[model samples]
Target: MPVDAPMPGSYGVRIPPWLAAEQATLPARITDRTERMRMVNRIAARNVEEGTGGPFAALVLDSDTGDVVSAGVNLVLSANVASAHAEVVALSLAQTRVGDWNLGTDPARPRALVGNAQPCVMCLGTLIWSGVKALDFSVPGFEVERITGFDEGPVPADWREQLEKRGIAVDTGLLQEECSTVLEDFRSRVAAGTITLYNGG
Candidate 1:
């Protein structure tokens, strides 16, 4: 749902091993990063259009030894509702090179469903369908289930059952107040570091 902060260098927290291995081929590059990412993005979108419903992130392999060069998450938003914004952004990045990109990961509740809800159910559902695992800090009003902890680990009973029934889980106590700022900083760090991929413009 709402992608949360996972251990920065840990590769297995949110992203699956198979996918990561697949993406490892593309070396992180700056020269044509944006354009290449966009091309891969179109492919992911096509997957969604074909009823795959993928906000799928693709890794651009080096084409020779299969080293991961870059990755990009696609299909930022589906329903056009303001509530789904964060999930879209997170998915966008996660599908890219920043493997475990956290989308806030903090426990949150929206005052109204209008333009504030984090990890909207629909958007989350789309992510789950794409086979991506996300760590949410807290999930409230959850009659179905609940999750616990900020890192990847065991979850609550209710949540386990819910996941068994429906392909999703929500954790509690993973909430943090500085999620947005941290997310911004993380992005800035990546963008700054990869300026060459964006052509150092």
Candidate 2:
């Protein structure tokens, strides 16, 4: 059991390596952004099938080496920890595995992160310091509220500009509607009372 951080009080959340190993091998060895996003959707779809609720999922990887550093899915329902968003889980494992927060210029791996949705407020906040190199995501933050009825809170209107300003290459709309379908699935199931949200409510 590894906590995401060594800070006091909250002690962060548990990061089991088994989960990391299971998701480490991404769907393929392709470098195209859209293909990468479709792979992320696969992880998300599995979450739905396994009854993990709104299992938003993410993968942390190294661009230069094309290695899946780690992968994460929402664990709030299973772990009873509200901090277990997919981006955070993936980012946390990534930071630990790389042994440093800043990894872009590293002599090896040259890390990055990819996710199925625009980062929620908390995950967006974590990225500036997570220090992978590039940020790639599938959906727009606005659609998160519109299509899924999930209120993504307080994302600074200029958040992307801010990340770019920090030298973090941020790419959005990777798979566009394809990625949205996963959210739509969750939304439909939630409406039917077949799926529940640990945090999305």
Candidate 3:
């Protein structure tokens, strides 16, 4: 390899046109936690049908007002990027929208990240660094691995404490049955050779 081999300078993932249109139809604010989780679950299920990526979707929301800041689905397969998980995409979009990398900068208007499933190891680090004040998820990592065969990596046993120590609130098992149903459906599709199962080392 040479220094001037005309290497690619940059790369990025864009939300699919369909997902963007769906986002446009979302209400300006969703105050109910159950409703938030329901939306994420629906998006995650649709991601599999859309053949975008794995069964996952996430959102960045104003914790206080429940205003949706950004929505993202797994684009790892479609975007050809391993790091394009739902949580990362949503967080990145939120950062870009606010023009600040640190989401917790505004103390009065804290943010929360809501996802269909628990974050993988890489996304755990992303969440820590993103400065979001809270995390809400529907399904656990074990369920994700059991149903989808996707490796979530070795998340720390004290993962909740890790986030709490940094002043990030943690909530889990929101609409677990619904979220797990989505994962189960994705597994069936994969078994039927209709969808690709992506698992990174």
Candidate 4:
């Protein structure tokens, strides 16, 4: 496995686990702060019913063999995920982003810049929902720098500044720079040698 790649069966959390739980159960009936939360939960529920696990994962069709390369959640179990709306958003994001293919429709095509950007929101929401015990977004890897507001520092300095600037009191512990799991896909690519290694030790 590439040293920089995430370990097998690990997924990082970009947000708080409890907060994600909150987002998972957003009130569908009330029209207020929980609207987005409700949407996320709905998506999760549908993912379970449909038997399409990895609501946070995306499929990448290998241009060479038409094989599917999955990144993010391995399977989006409906039981694990409890919202239909959230499933829509997550699946949509995965289809549109992640993996070697950049085009949402064609997984074989590789558009590193745009395609890589697709997993941001889903990843964030998943980590929250999964109760990610740890996480690490710092360090430049796999187009990580291209993310506008992400950083490798101990704290999400950029996210903090933006929230504070907007007068939003950021109270989530998930924001702190802590090491955590990154799902099994990260290791699968390495064992398969799909992800290339560069730079120096």
lDDT of 2 by residue, 67-165 (tens): 677778877766677778888888887777778766565646556789888888888878777777788888887887787787677889999899889
TM match of model 4 to true structure: 0.22
Candidate that would win on TM-score: 3
| 2 versus 3: better lDDT goes to | 3
lDDT of 4 at 102: 20
- Listed in order, each prediction's TM-score against the native is 0.27, 0.83, 0.96, 0.22
- Best candidate per lDDT, number? 3
Best first by lDDT, ranked: 3, 2, 1, 4
Each candidate: RMSD to true structure?
A: 18.6, 5.1, 2.1, 16.9
lDDT of 4 by residue, 10-37 (tens): 4322322433454345332332222222
Q: How many clashing pairs in candidate 1?
A: 26
Reference-based TM-score, model 1: 0.27
* Cα-based lDDT at residue 37, candidate 2: 80
Query: Candidate 4: where are CA atoms >4 Å away?
Result: 1-157, 172-179, 193-201
Which of 1 and 2 is the better model by TM-score?
2
- Candidate 2 positional error at 100, Å: 3.1
Local accuracy by lDDT, each model: 0.32, 0.74, 0.92, 0.29
Least lDDT summed over 10 consecutive residues: which range in candidate 3?
1-10
**Considering TM-score, where higher is better, how would the candidates rank from best to worst?**
3, 2, 1, 4
